[model samples]
Target: MLYDLFLKPYEGYSTLFIVLEAIAAFFGIVSVWFARRNSIWVYPTGIISTVLYVYVLFVSGVYGDAVINIYYTAMSLYGWYVWLNVKGEGQALPITWLHRRSALFTGGFTLANFALFYIILQYYTDSIVPTLDAITTALAFSAMYLMARKKVESWAFWIACDVISVGLYIYKGLGVTALQYLIFLILAISAHFEWVRLYREQQAAQAHPGNTTTKPA
Candidate 1:
């Protein structure tokens, strides 16, 4: 049973996939670690992971995931530049919450993307789990966009996406990637709290601008 749950999936796959997935997972963890610290290294490391996954997911026949990885790669580059310019001297980009209007737009966009992808994947491709794939892909799109903007709510989307992805990847017989998502879920939860703390600190600093001792950024 254990073999079936784990090793059985690797039976016909190339050793290249195992190696690629492991490397991607390692860099993915590193990227999240940098993100938690609000470091600029996050985008570089994330680009590596997402680039590899683009190939992996494409070969695995998960087209939605493949496309999202491509999007991630592009976003990582954009984010790298944004983060570099957004920070002032001795400060990181301020973590922020989404406005209600922005939140509504994001939510609507995710749903629309999901619906469109579901229809395309279901009708145009031979994808095994089109609905789940579409759902995860849509969530990831919103999460990645928010993360690039240094929004605290991005972690919430990531936490949700990571949890669903664990089951999704496992069902797709990619146990290693599934385990990676499990780790991602934990990191996303930790990041959520950390970002919230940072946001609070930033808020307090703004309220007490005269206090030079408060290191909000």
Candidate 2:
């Protein structure tokens, strides 16, 4: 099916795919953009995007992605509550870095997801686009997990994932999705630097009186 997309170009199919992709991508960008500014609206926008993609990916025969969106929806709901109402030590934590052990666990889990995806794609699904989809899916899972945890390094993972997603979308003849991923690639880079700068100024603020300032806005 994927080969046929390029081997025998289907204009109608491409057009319909582009429409759905655009809707999903738009909300995704909005959510991630809000997230960079430490805004709480990210989860709401993410919910919409995930809901849309669940149907979209399922129709496209990317079952893993479809399933993942279900998880994304659930996680978004959980994160929403956690962000708004949860407090630690009588204060809501703004943002925090992952501990060393947590980082190690994340890396290990990502690797495990990749291995599982590879095995499932290579053997179970007969999807011609399985390998590519699986790779992106695994990366997305890692990136989403980091984001949910409020880790600064999530942007790094997003940069890597979105860059690869661009190539994958373009290869799959999803031109609009490719463009969305391209835009996301740039945003992810910006968010990474933005978060790092924010983290630095935060640390400095703790040391000094009121001199250090880092505004993600």
Candidate 3:
């Protein structure tokens, strides 16, 4: 049953492609795990994963996702820089809630991305699942941006994108990738709550700086 579900889809595919997917999936999971812990390593691990998936998705004819991975690679670099340089002295960037204005901007940006990719996929590419691809790609783009900004809402976008991508990859005969997205869905949900808690802790720390353990007795 396991073989039928996972390996069967790759019966005629090259072993190299299958191995690549597995490796990419591994790094992707590690990246998300780092993000959950609010660690700086997330960007580096995510860069590796996204770079691999850019090639994987392009070869598989998922042009929108290929583009998303390219964007992810570029954004990962920017995010890494922001995380390192924008911190307060020795502290990391504080996880925060998205502002109302930022939320509205993200919604508009996602919709625009969807329309743009849909048009390109429908006209320029021979993509079979243009709508699904565009939707997931757009959602992921917003998620990546918000994540780099250290907003808690980024996980929400990732949750939605992962849910759609799980089915999308299944339909595309990428069983391993489909499984990866399912795992991503779970991790995103967990990360949302974790980030929320972390945000609250940040607020508490700001409110009670004197209560820190570093305070002299």
Candidate 4:
């Protein structure tokens, strides 16, 4: 069972897929690490991972995932620019919480995308596990958008999506990808707390204008 879940990909799946997925997963880890640190490298690393996943998922016939990867790539580019320009005290984009109105919009948009993708995958294609695929893809869309905007709530969406995706990838027989999501789940949880701390520090700094020691950015 251990071998099947971990090592079997090299034998059961195509060598190309194993290699590509591994590469994508590696950079994905890196991207998340950079994101946790609020580093600018996150977008570049994320772009590479998403672009590779687009090809990987498309060839594997997970069209919903492929489409999301494409969306991720575009968002990564936009995020790169956004992060570059939005300067705080030290030229870093300030971390922020989502506004109430933005939160409602995000919720609605996520549900709408889930429904749209579910219908498309169910009717237009012979996609296996279309409902789960649509769900994970939609959550991912929301998470990516929030992250691009540097919202602290993005980690919550990521944590939820990563947990669901662990089961989804396992069900699809992509064991390595399942493992990646498990790691992502852990990272997202940690990132949530870390970002919350950062947000609080930023808030404190804003309240105390003379405190030069706490640079939340």
Candidate 5:
């Protein structure tokens, strides 16, 4: 009943939809796991997920979602470089804490993205769900920026976005999309704890001497 009811219009598109969702889910989970391990491959996997979702979301009339995916693609590339080249003086970029400046910039970017999405959705798409679209758009942008900077709070934001996104996908009758978001929710929780552990270990390494010199490797 559910699949049939939700999938009536997209029956012809089923194969394509399922394929994209499967690829997105695979890459999204891998990306999150890589991020928790502080690995550089996270960005490339993330780009794969977002780029496919951009095409998927656009066909679903989710203009804001498509736009967010575009930004995510760009963020993935930028994050790839930042994760590789960004290093502090003596410590290397050891999951640096979010500074006051970054917080302010992220907040400002979220607000601007929200406004821009709202206007686009309202004027361009006949979507009554524009408000929800804008909210998720802003949340995703902030979360990506936080993730690029290796902020611990990025996981929490992603968890929230996944939860809401699950509902949105279900409502939009995208069964595969809903399933992907559910998987994302679980990974987001994992990321939160993993990063917290890394942060604690990082702090400990700073406080102690020879014993603290050991790395996560």
Candidate 6:
């Protein structure tokens, strides 16, 4: 039963393609794991996964996902630089909560991305799940942007994106990718809480400088 549900789907695909997907999935998991730990390695690992997925997802006819992976590649480069740069003296970029204004901007940006992706996928491409693709892609785009800035809300966007993508990939016959999203969902949720705790710790240190020791995020 499990074989029929899982391995059977990929029986028609080439071994090379299957191996590529698995490798992409592995790097994707590593990238997110690094992100959860607030490590700088996330960007390089993520760039590798995203570049691989850009090809894999494109061949799989998941055009929205392919496009987002392309965006992720560029964003990873930008994020890497942003994460490395210091503020005031030489302190690394700290984890921060999205303020009200930034939250509003993110919402607007996500909506715009949704509209653009929907239009292109629906009319321009022969995409099967245009709406779902657009939804997940838009959410992921914003999530990537926020994550580049080390914002706590990035995990929230990732959580929503992963939840929707789990069903989307399953419906699209990408079982392995669906499983990846399921893992991503779990990690995103855990990362959210961990980041919140880190943010609070930073706040506490700032409030009581003499009593609390500051840690790099």
Off by over 4 Å in 6: 88-90, 210-217
Expressed as tens digits, the lDDT of each residue in 90-123 for candidate 6 is 4678899889999999999999999999999999
Q: Report the Cα lDDT for residue 9, model 6.
A: 75
Error of 1 at 86 (Å): 3.1
Candidate 2 lDDT over residue span 50-94, tens digit each: 998888767666676776788789888877777666453333334
Off by over 4 Å in 1: 210-217
Prediction 5 global C-alpha lDDT: 0.80
lDDT for position 86 in model 3: 47
RMSDs, each prediction? 2.2, 4.1, 3.3, 2.2, 2.8, 1.8
What is candidate 3's lDDT per residue for 56-114, written digit by digit as tens?
88988999999999999999998888777643444666678888998999999999999
Ten-residue stretch with the least lDDT total in model 2: 86-95
TM-score of each: 0.93, 0.83, 0.94, 0.92, 0.86, 0.94
Q: By TM-score, highest first, what's the ranking?
A: 6, 3, 1, 4, 5, 2
Residue clash pairs of candidate 3: none
Residue 97 of model 1, lDDT score: 93
Tens-digit lDDT string for candidate 5 (1-217): 7656356646768786868867987887787778778777788888999999888888788778888899999998887777666344334456756789877887788889889888988888877589888888889999988888789888877987898888887778777678778888988898899889988888887787554322222
Write down the lDDT of every candidate, Cα atoms only: 0.87, 0.75, 0.87, 0.85, 0.80, 0.90
94-209: candidate 1 lDDT, tens digit per residue: 67999999999999999999999999999999999999899999999999999989899899889988988999998988888898899999999999999898778778888997
Give candidate 5 regions above 4 Å deviation.
Answer: 5-9, 86-92, 209-217
Give the per-residue lDDT digits (tens) of candidate 4, residues 1-217.
8787677645756878888999998998889888887777888999989998998888777889889999999999988888877445554567899889999999999999999999999999888889988998899999999998889999998998898889987767777778888988988899999989977887898798775422222
Rank list by lDDT = 6, 3, 1, 4, 5, 2
